[model samples]
Target: MAEQIIAALEKIVGANQVLRGDRAKPYLTEWRRAFQPVALAVVRPGNTGEVAALVQSCADFDCAVVAQSGNTGLVGGSAASDARRHVIVNLERMDRVREIDADNATMTVEAGCTLADAQQAAADAGLYFPLTLASRDRCRIGGNLATNAGGLNVVRYGNTRDLVLGLEVVLADGRVWHNLSGLRKDNSGFDLNDLFVGSEGALGVVTAAVFKLYDPVVQQVTALFALDAPEQAVALQRRLIAASGHNLTGCELMSRQAVSLACTHIEGCHEPFEVDHDWYLLVDLASSAQGHWLHEVMAQVVEHARRDGLLSDVVIAHDDERAAALWHLRESLPPAQVAEGASIKHDISLPISKLPMFLARALPAVREALPGVRPCPFGHVGDGNLHFNLSKPAGADDETFLAQSETAHTVVHDIVAEMGGSIAAEHGIGRLKVEALSRYKQPVERDMMRAIKAALDPDNRLNPGVIVD
Candidate 1:
């Protein structure tokens, strides 16, 4: 059966594209190395037609197919994990810029285009694609669409799902479902494009996407501030949101431990001005009004925050170079934490109003449960999404604390659930948090999700064992 399928896939995409044995090793592992996946082969298809044909060949042999892009996912969904019974369908070869409808404020690009490439394409057309991530240079548009990725700009533009106008997908049976509509108000039917957006490749493979672009920012103002407490950051954020409105492009918070870790582990990242504080916020404000609009609003926010005793110290970027430096510090936290040691990570979202209360309760509970566990919680707090990751304390056994991950996760997730929050915020439940999803999600909602999965990929040939059983 393996020989037959390989031969058929080689015919669809060239023989050189059909990888086997050692050639398939690269495609079988995710960025974080949570687990190594075993696959029979990796097939690289150059276009939608080839992808459909490859999917068809897999179906013909009754083999499960796992779709891959820039395998940079934190969760294990980027590769198969059950056993060596899957065929990997990688989309890097299909990278292309099909069209840029700038007049219509939309760009149609193939799925394999890197997030950075997509953003650059929009910029080259004098527009802006607002999906920004640290891995933008590596993560692909396909994975971004499949996971409904959220990043720094979600408070302004929205998630990958919101920015997308339409999708070109290859279904389980290799039939192409092309709905590349760029209409702003298309209430014609069931909003079918949503099904595959955050499906995490459970239903189908996203081949290409029509993404909505917006007016480019003529000027941007970035600021870094030391906060007296985490709640102060929240209070200042509320005032800024009311005062600045949509001009507030991004808001992020880093706990003191998170900052120290970033400064200690990451090169060129350090405490600004040698000042010490309990928490810090990195704010990005931009305006299309061309002149002084960003400066006026951001200055007002900083002035007001200080008056309210919310800010301890503040530094506003006077030029583009300084702005880039501030952003680099904010983006360096994740890798810094990774460099420190093994940690249990949580990607969670909460009601903006309840963030302080959730943090107040969750922090102490987890610390008590596992005393000396270093909590490194940070992320886009502007939109209420926090990457609440925890690093093991110095001199602690990595394996021992990692073993207590379930306990640590439960403590945090329980509070999140009670506060009307989601356990998996920006990161999708890609085989990493499936049980947590099932536990926290209502049964009826789970049933509906399962029903959708059953209807679309009845054979479970595409991205099996992800998002759903």
Candidate 2:
């Protein structure tokens, strides 16, 4: 049966493009090593037509199809986890920048193009693509759109979903929906592009997209402030946003433990302050309007924060190089955690005003539940999303520490639910968080999602057991 499936895939997209067994191992595994998938074969499609054909062929054989691009997703969304017959449809081969309309401020590119490459392409055209991730070099625009990824710039530019103007998708039935018009406003029928964004490939495969761009930033300022608590960061952020006239592009919060981990594990990442503090806030402000005015705006905010006793010490970056250095400390937190040891991570979001209270409650609860567990909470607090990760107890076994994941999740997520926060923030409800989604989501909302899934792929052939199940 597997042999027949492989032969059919080869017929659609050349024999060399079809990989099986050991050759397909790379596509079958996701990042972070959380979920190891088993697929009958991995097919590489070079164009939209080939992707459509592959999907149609998989439906004909009753084999589930998983749409993958870049495979840089943190959750188990891009890979198959069950033992069912599955064919991995990887889009890495369909990388091309179809067009870049400078006047329209939109760029159309294949889903397989890396985020870094796309950003560079926009930069070459003297424009800016605001959506960025630390994994930009490895993550593809398709996966970014599929997951509706949010990163540092979300506070200013919003998520991948917001930056997109149109999408070219292949539905579960192998039919193509082409609407890459780069239209800013159109109220024709339902907003179909939205259904696929952040759907985690359960609805369809994003073949290509038209992304919105912005004017190139002419002046930018970066600053780091040492604070005593998350509340201080929040308070200072409000002052800066109001004073800067909303030019605050990004604001990130890091716990002392998180900062220490990054300084210890990552090379060239040094502490910004002379003395230690309990928390740190990284600030970014950009303006296309030319002037040294942004620097003055940052300095004034710093002075006000100090007067209000909101911060202890602050460091401001005046040049592009220093700005990059300051930003490095913020971006290095993730890789630093990987080096620290085994940790259970949660990507969650709450009301901007409720972050302080949520932290006040969740911190002690998780610690009391698991004694000596190191909490390294940090993330894009400007947009109210925190990467609330917990490092295992000192000298604890990895397996033993991981065993408490369910307990820790319950402790942390229960508080989140009470606070009206989402368990899955930027990351989608992939296979890893499917059960939690089922438990936390409202029944009405869940039923609507399931109805859409059933209507699109009744057999569950497109990414079966993902998001819906």
Candidate 3:
């Protein structure tokens, strides 16, 4: 049966594009090595037609199909679940920049195109893509849309979903939906694009998309502000937003432990302040008007916050090099955590105003549940998303610490739920958070999602064990 399925997939994408046995190892394994899944074959589809045909072939063979692009997702959304019964549909070879319309301020790119490449394409045309992730160089556009990824620029530009104008998707039944229009205003029925953007491939495979672009930022300011606690960071953020509005492109919050870990593990990362504070806020403001006004506004806001005792220290980047260095520290947090040791991480979000309360309650509860756990919390505080991760105690057994993941998750997630927050934030509810989604999500909401999933993929052939089930 596996051979029959692989042969069919090979016929669709050509024999050279179909990988199996040892060759399929990389596609079968998840990036974090959390789940070592198995698959009959890894099929690289070269175009939308090939993807649709492959999906149909997998369904006819009664084999599950998992849509994967870049395979950089932390969640097991792109990994196969069943041995020999799943065929991985990888889109790496489908990479292409279809079109760029400067008059419309939009660009159309294939699903497999790396985000870094897309950003460069926009830059070459004297525009900005505005979806900036740490993994931009490797993570593809399809996965970004599937996960509805949020990054540094989300405060100003919004999530991957918001940046999209239209999408060309291959539905579960080998039917292609060609809605790739760059029109800003489309009163068409139902807004079907939203259904697939964050579906994690349960509904369809996002083949290509039209994305909104913006003018290049000519003047920018990056700064790191020292604060005593999360509340101070929130207060300062509110002040900055009030003063600068949409010009505030990025605002990140980092705990002392998080910063310390980054500085220790990452070579270029260093503590910018003379005296270490309990917390830090990394923020940047940008404008295309080309003047010192952006900097002046940011400086005035920071100085005023300092006078109000909301900040203890401030280090503003005066050059592009320093700005990149500061961003490097922010982007290096995840890798630094990996370098530190095993961790149980949470990508959760809450209302910006409720952030302090959530942190205050979650930290103590997590500590009580898992004693000696190192709480290293930080993330895009401007957008209310926090990577509240708990590192294992020094000299502790990795397995033993990981064994307590359930307890730690319950302790932290309960608080998040109580505060009207989402258990899964930027990252989609892949296999890891499926159970949590069932537990935290309202019964009606869950039922609706399941109904939609059933309607789209009745056999659950596309990315099984993803968003819905």
TM-score of each: 0.98, 0.98, 0.99
Lowest-scoring 10 consecutive residues by lDDT in candidate 3? 237-246
lDDT of 2 by residue, 382-415 (tens): 9999999999887888889988999999999999
Off by over 4 Å in 2: 82-84
For candidate 1, lDDT tens digit of each residue in 408-431?
989999999999999988778988
Name the lDDT value of residue 117 in candidate 3: 96
The reply for model 1, stretches above 4 Å from the true place, is 82-84
lDDT of 1 at 396: 82
| Best-to-worst ranking by lDDT | 3, 2, 1
Cα lDDT of all candidates, in order? Answer: 0.86, 0.90, 0.90
Model 2 poorest 10 in a row by lDDT: 78-87
lDDT of 3 by residue, 1-469 (tens): 7778878888888999999888888787787778888877888999999999998888898888888999999888897878778888899898898999999999999999999999999999999999989999999998999999998888888999999999999988889999888878988688898888899989998999999999999999999999988899888877887887668889999999899999999989998888999999999988888678878888789778877889888999999999999999999999999999899999999999999999889888888889899999999999899999999998888899999999999998999998899998898888889999999999999999999999999988888888786
* Superposed Cα RMSD, model 1: 1.2
C-alpha lDDT of candidate 3 relative to the true structure: 0.90
